[model samples]
Target: ITGELINIINSPDTSEDEHLLSVNFIQADTKGPEFKTTYNSTAQAIRIEFSTLELVLHQGVVLR
Candidate 1:
């Protein structure tokens, strides 16, 4: 399948440059959900995932 070829081309070892991804400003309508991810220091492989939160508390946000 074409998907397999694309995967082979995108394999991490093919690139000398570091790959980085960031997520920001995710909001939810409920409360208290956990957040996490996993990445190897060697950069051989990586996976990232996160769950949406209902209103992440901040340092300066005024609460009613």
Candidate 2:
């Protein structure tokens, strides 16, 4: 998956400030892979990576 982050700043003298971040993820053919999170304050970005299976059945699974 891919995503972007933006930070907006407003000021009287300045018009506007924006910060952008882009990220991508790759999946492996493995089981029970661990993931982690990262934070960047200056760039105003957060990233997370995880591995899981996505299934699409005729009827969706029910959750309680």
Off by over 4 Å in 1: 1-43, 56-64
Q: What is candidate 2's lDDT per residue for 1-64, written digit by digit as tens?
A: 1344432332223223422333555543333233232221222334554333344432222331
Clashing pairs in 1: 28-53, 28-54
Q: Which candidate leads in lDDT?
A: 2
lDDT of 2 at 31: 33
What are the TM-scores, per candidate, against the unseen true structure?
0.19, 0.19
Q: List the residue pairs that clash in candidate 2.
A: none
lDDT of each: 0.33, 0.34
lDDT at 63, model 1? 42
> Candidate 2 overall Cα lDDT vs. reference?
0.34
Q: Count clashing pairs, candidate 1.
A: 2
- lDDT (Cα, tens digit) per residue for candidate 1, span 1-64: 2343222122233234433333444433232232222321232333464333234443433343
